[model samples]
Target chain A: MLSCKEAAALVSESLDRKLPLGQRIALRMHLLFCRFCRRFSRQVLFLRGTADRVRGEKEGEEPPVSDSLSAEAKEKIEQALKTHSESKSKP
Target chain B: MSIIDPSKGKGETLNPENWGKDYADYLFRYALVRLRDRQGAEDVVQETFLAALKGKDQFKGLSSERTWLVGILKHKMMDYFRKPSRELPVSGLITSEDPPEEFFDLNGKWQVKPSSWGDSPMDALEKKEFWKTFEACMSVLPGRLAQIFALREFEGLKNEEICNLFNVSTTNLNVMLFRSRMRLARCLETNWFGKKAKGE
Candidate 1:
C-alpha cells in the first residue's frame, strides 16, 4: 500500500497524468484497497473537474467567460490612445 | 463570440486585424484572462500590434509569426502587471492545519480515499446543483488561489506561463499550486462527503 505522503504526491501528478507506470500501478493498487485514500483521490479529481466546469459553464451552458469589458471602457481606451498619439506626434 | 479588431488601421498594411483569426483570438483571450477586463484586453491587443509593427524589421526567420506576436503580448502583460501601483494578491490559508499532520492522521493514515466515491464521479459533475455547491465552496477561496487555480487548471496554461505572468518563482508557484489542489480536495470532502460522515 502507498504511504500517505506517496498518495498525496500522486494526487497532483494524477491531475497532469504524469505519473510513471510503475508508480501508477502502485498508486492504483493502494487506492483499490484503501478506503480513505480512495476518498482523497476522488476529491482531488473532483476539484480539477470543478475548476474546468466553473470556468466554462454558463447559466445556459453557453460558456464560462472571464468578464468582458464594456463598450464605454473600450471607447475610453481609444480616446486615451488618440490623445497619447497626438501628444507624441506634437513633440 | 463576435470577432473584434480595431478599425483605426483599416485597409492599412500594419494592423492586427490583418492577422489570422486564431492568433488574434489567442492573444485576445490570453489578455482577457490576465487583465480580467475587456478594454484592458483591447489596449493590450493594440499595444501588442504596435510593438509587433515597430519590431517588424527584427522578425528574423527564426520564430513563427504567431510566436513573435505572443512574445510581444507577454511583454505588454508583464509591463502592465509589473507596474508599481498595484499589489499582486496571493492566496492565504484558512482554518489552517499543520503540515504532515493536516495531510495525514496521527497514525500516518490517509483521511480519505484517493480514487472514487460509491457513485460515478462524472454523474456528480454533470448536475447543475453539484457545480453550484462547488462554486459556492470555491468563491470564498482566497483571491490568490482563484487566480492560480484558474490559470493552471482551468485555463490549461503551463506552470511556466503562470510563473512568467505572475512573476512568481518556480518554488513559490509549485507551493501555490500544491496548496490549491490540497484546498480543493478538502472543500470537495466537506461539500460532498461530510454529510455521509454524519450519517455514518
Candidate 2:
C-alpha cells in the first residue's frame, strides 16, 4: 500500500514521464480512497497548467510586476558594449 | 514593411551603439524571469550584448537584430545555469533534507490534507491579478527549486536533458521536480485558491 507521501511523489513523476504499470496502479488505488491525495493530484496538474500558461505568454508583453533592470546595470552594460566595439574597431 | 527582392539582400543593419537603449530591458526581463537573480540576470544580459558585439560580423541579417540578440541571450542563460562554479550551490539541492516530510507525517500520511480549491483552476489562471500572486509565489521559492522549475516548465527542457545538465539520477530529478511543484501548488493554494474559497 503506497502512502500519501509516496503516492504524491508518483503523481508528480507522472507529469515528467511515464510510470511503470505497477506503480501507476498503486498510485491509482491510493488516490481512489484518499480525497486529499486526489485533490493533490488535481492541484499538481493545476500547477503544471498554470506554469505552462505563465511561460507561454509572449515575452516583453509587460510583466505584471513593474520591476526593471536598474539604471546603473543598464549603464554598465552599455559601457561594456562601447568598450568592446571600440577595441574591435582598433588595430 | 517593404517587400524585399530575394536577389537583393535585405541588408538588415546592426546598430550596436543603440542596442543597449533598444533591447537591454527586453533581454533583462527575459533573463530575470528565468534566472530570478538580479545579479545573474544582469551578468547574462551584459554577456549577451558583449557576445553579440564580438560576433556582429556573423549577423547575416537573416533574423531581426532583436531576435538574434535574444537567441544569444538564451544560450548565455543556459550556460549560466550549467556553469561548473554553480555546482557548489546546486549540489546543496541534492543533499537538502527530504521535503515530503513537511507535508506528510512519520506514517507518511498527509499532515494537512489538501483542501478543496473549488472549480475552474483555469478561471484563476486567466485573471490578470492571479499572475501577481503567481509571481509572488515564484519569487519566494527557494533558489534551487526555482531554477529547476524554470528550466523544466518555463524553458520546456526535457527531463533527460535536465538530468544530464544537473548530473542527477532520474529519481533525484523527479524528487526535485516533485518538491518544487508541491511548494508552488501549496503557495498558490494558500495565497490564491484558498483565499478565493473563503471569499476573503
Candidate 3:
C-alpha cells in the first residue's frame, strides 16, 4: 500500500500530467482507505479553481474583482505612454 | 484623434488614448496577483503598453485587443522571471525540512485524516476576502515556486512549455509544482479555512 505521503505526491503529480497506470492504480487503492489523501485531492482541485479565478478565468460566474491599479499608477502609465508617443512622432 | 482606423483592420483599432482606460486596471490586477509586487506589476503594465504601441501596426485582428495586450504582458512576466536577480534560492523550498508529523506517522501511515471543508470553499469563492486571503498566502510563497505555480495554474502553460521557460528538467519542475501545491494547501487550511471554522 502507498503511504499517505507517497499517495499525496501522486495526487499532486496527477494534476500536471497523466499518471502511469501502475501509479494510478496504487493511488486509487491508497485513497480508498485514506480520508486525508482524499481531502488533499479535493484541496488541490480547490486550489486550482482559486488560481483560475485569480487569472480571471471564471469571468461571468466569479464575484467582482476587488483589486485594481491605483489612480497614481494609471497616471504614471499615461505619462509614460505620452512620452513614448511624443518620441515616436519626433524626427 | 482616432488612432485605430477600422478601414485598416477587421477588429476595432487600438486607440492609444484609451489604452489606460481600457486595459490598465485589468492588466495591473493580473500582474499584481502573479508578481505580488505593486510597483513591479505597475512597471510591467507600463512596459506592456509601450511595447504594444511600438508593435501596434502588427495587430492583425487575430484576437481581441485585450488578448493581444495580455499576450504581451505574459511575455513581460516571463522576462521578469528569467532575470537572475529575481530568481529565488530554490534549494531549500521542499526538501530541507522534515515532513510534518500530522500528515504521516513514522511508519508512513496517515496520523491525521484531512477533515471535510464542507461547502465553505465553494462559498468562499464568491467572497472578496477569500481572494485577499488567497493572495496573501500566495505572496508568502518563495518567489520561484510562486512564479512556476502561477505559470502552471493561472497561465495554463503546458508542462513542456514551463520546463522550456525555466530551463529545468521535467522532474525538477514536477517536484517544485508538488511542493508549491502542498504549501498553498497548508496555507489556506490555516489562514482561510481555520479562520472560517472559528467564525473569524
Highest-TM-score candidate: 2
lDDT of each: 0.60, 0.84, 0.81
- In order of DockQ, best first, we have 2, 3, 1
| Interface RMSD per candidate (angstroms) | 5.8, 2.1, 2.6
Order of all candidates by TM-score, from best down to worst?
Answer: 2, 3, 1
**Considering TM-score, which of the candidate structures 1 and 2 is the better prediction for this target?**
2
Q: Could you give the TM-score of chain B for each candidate, in order?
A: 0.50, 0.85, 0.79
As a whole number from 0 to 100, the lDDT of residue B50 in candidate 3 is: 95
Per-residue lDDT of model 3, residues B58-120, tens digit only: 988766678788899999988876777765466644442434455578877766556677775
Better of 1 and 3 by TM-score: 3
Model 1 lDDT tens row, B3-122: 334343222133333453334455665566545545657777768766665676666535446667777886886676656553453344321232435666666576543434557665
| Candidate number with greatest DockQ | 2
Score every model by TM-score. Answer: 0.54, 0.87, 0.84
DockQ score of each predicted structure, in the order shown: 0.31, 0.68, 0.59
Task: Give lDDT: candidate 1, residue A80.
Answer: 54
Clashing pairs in 2: none
| Model 3 per-residue lDDT tens digits across residues A1-91 | 8988889978988998899999999999998988889999999999888776766653323323457888999999999988998899899
